[model samples]
Target: MPYFAVLYDYAPGSDPLREHHRAAHRAYLNETDHGTVAVVATGPWSDGEPGALLVVSAPGPGELHAMLDRDPFRLHGAVAQRRIRSWTPVTGPWA
Candidate 1:
């Protein structure tokens, strides 16, 4: 499996939608299969931007995208942009 760093940019003024779907979103992440696509770490950015960063392990980008597509936030258009990049950890807990 390969690791990926995913960045999600929330849509402008979509806080209501995100709040409404937050439970389902968390549940989805919690219920994901470890062998398939494990969510290593995830959290919202504390900066001025309204977005989140997620480190996940999966077979590839296609599989990761498929899994993410099922998230409530993505389904309800709370996520305006998504950036996926391959990650190789050298000297961290993930390594």
Candidate 2:
């Protein structure tokens, strides 16, 4: 498996939308939060902002896309921008 870092930028005034889907979002993440093909860690970049960083593991880009495509926030038009990249960890607790 390879690591993929996902950056999600959401539209403004989407707070309500995000809150509405918070449970489902968290549930999904918690259910698949770690393993060979799952979300490694995720959270908001700052307060009162809809930006998030999700480090995940998957076989390739296709699987990554498929996994992220199901995000409740993204499905409801909360996400304005999404960037995914392959990452190579050199050293650290997560390495």
Please report the candidate that would top lDDT against the real structure: 1
Q: Mind giving the per-residue lDDT tens digits that candidate 1 earns over 12-61?
A: 99999999999989888888574489998888998778999999999998
Q: lDDT per model, in order?
A: 0.91, 0.85
Candidate 1 wrong stretches, greater than 4 Å: none
**In angstroms, what RMSD does candidate 1 have relative to the true structure?**
1.2
Question: Model 1: what TM-score?
Answer: 0.94
Q: How much does each candidate deviate from the true structure in C-alpha RMSD?
A: 1.2, 2.1
For model 2, residues 42-81, the per-residue Cα lDDT tens digits are 9999775669999998999987887788888889988999
TM-score of each: 0.94, 0.88
Q: What is the lDDT of residue 17 in candidate 1?
A: 100
